[model samples]
Target: MVKCRALKRLKDAPPSTPSKKQAILQHYMCVSPTAKQSLKRQSPSLSEKVLENMKGFIHETKQKRNSDARNAMHVISASVSGEKISKGEKSKAARKLGLQPRRLSGGQRIRTSVLRSEKSCYEFTKRKTRSDITSDETKKQAYDFWISPTVSHTSSNKTDVKRSRIGPNEYVSHQIHLLEKTQTEVFLDFKAKYPDFKISQRLFESYKPFFVMPVKQKHRNTCCCRQHIEVRILFKKCMEFRKNLHASNLDLTQENLPVFEHLNDICAETVCDKTALHAQCLNRSCKECGVEKLSFNDNELDTSRNARDIKWDKFEYTEINVKGRKTRTKLMLVSKKTKPGEMFNHFKSLLETFPAHQNRANWQSEQY
Candidate 1:
């Protein structure tokens, strides 16, 4: 009724009559106690001209409030879409906008009024079941691919073997195989091979055989040959020398330091055929294969210790008397200054002595 009265007064007022405008304003103040109170609360210093344009001012204020609300809604939508805001932030925004938050089936609570607005509606998609996503044949194919001998080689270590129970009093032993690539790498390779088949990383990992293990440092054979060991030691020494040079503010290039590649080149040039194993080449006394030494300047190389004379302490199982009882214990065995050739010959002699018996015993043990 107040709005109607105000509009009726506005229409009846003359286009350029001060008396007419004054009459309309007086009518509004007399009829609407709220408008009179609002006008009174305004600054007393407000001029008559400002009062004349009060309607326009109120309209502008309403428009600004609406514009602010719209902008806030847009900001909230952008944040929600980009996943920049947390649930708490969404709740706080909703509360500020006088909107109630609603909880979804997934336990996520959000402002339905903001997220599910006409401009941008939040959509929820039903997750596909395993059977729906992948057919049985596809799963079987994936399993077969994962368990293939070529993809993952069987571990030679007996400790790595695993046994699984199939039924009551029934069990099956599997020779554990180590995967050549990481789980992610394997999945990528599988995807490359079967582009049509869609599988997530988690799903691919689940499909991996329990017997198939990832390659780790512990899984590697730490034992290296004498030549390789010497090379490793040489590399360490070179690294230390380089570090020392760096500490002393001296420029040390590759030419100043000995590298494994140089030693490898020497071996390639003087040793047996490249196809032959390093151990085999070193063992054979062929005219073509012989030991080659790398010569370095006295200043460049550390001659404090001789590499050839370095001996390794080995642990051997020895019978010891403990409280008059014979018990086998590992004792540190110090090696004599025996050449590789002499050691090889000594072992060859021992093997020859027990060759027939050893072969028979090994055959019997394998059968069991």
Candidate 2:
């Protein structure tokens, strides 16, 4: 009776200052019948507790996964192998669990490509097994291999010089030596021997000091016949005379010129040949009217005799002493002061200027 009287007093109070009992009554009236039944069956705090429990369960699963010895694949394999599960079973499990399997995407493919390229580069630059490292023989072998025309080639397809045990600087020096040697040695032979070197005629050209040659086979063994022997003797004599002249410290004079007559013959024979005369040859001659007229000659030779009309150019002439009389004689400026190597190159240049041919009459109209 007392509690009922208190409720009546609370409801009878002014609306502006409504009591807590009046608010509770209004909330109960506004709610549906189902919400009323749920409120009675379950406590409001119980739902928050259930949510907290679920969160803790998820956290425990994550920790278990992190603590596993191997990967998910291992776990999946063990699970499937024990139950004889197939792909269909796995997919059904995934669907039932509302879980999506991890998969690689386009971004993954790009990343994998980058990773593979980096791995290859690392493998290429990594150290390898070498039994003969830091040995004198190894270094020497490396040097020889580096300088050899045969071994120098593409960086991709490197020769087996890693075992040679030489330093990078030493290898570079070996390369320099090889380049220098190419100028002297026959190019075709050099290329044949060092096919990997990738040394081209155009590369030799970049270095002005070296002479470039065509890539073709040449006779390895030349004849040492009487004519060859005589020519060789003449060349030796000329070289000897030039050395003697240089050693003499003598001034320019006609008396010293006659000894070089044989040398002049050699020079003329070299210059008027098909090679020298045809290369950059104007093929012009001085006519009676004092005008230079174009002339052409067949690249022919009379090898039957020691000397013949080369007809390409006049023999070099300079004032010389013969029996105490000054007269025009062949000049020998080529051998006067040049080194042996330089002399050989100069002569060779003359020889290769024109093409070679057999004996013929008026063959200028046709190509050799």
Query: Among these predicted structures, which one has the highest lDDT?
Result: 1
Model 2 alpha-carbon miss at residue 270, Å: 6.3
lDDT of 2 by residue, 85-171 (tens): 444565554443333322112223333343334233222222332343334333333334433445232121122112121243211
Q: Which pairs of residues clash in candidate 1, taking residues 3 or more apart in a chain or in different chains?
A: none
Off by over 4 Å in 1: 1-132, 148-151, 157-252, 259-280, 284-291, 296-368
Kindly list the per-residue Cα lDDT of model 1 for residues 157-234, writing each as its tens digit. 567766544445433345677788777888888889999887788887766655677765444543333433434344
Q: Given candidate 2, what's the lDDT at residue 72? A: 45
- lDDT for 208 in candidate 1 is 62
Where does candidate 2 stray beyond 4 Å?
1-140, 146-223, 234-258, 261-265, 269-368
In candidate 2, list every pair of residues with a backbone clash: 149-194, 150-194, 152-197, 254-321, 274-354, 275-353, 275-354
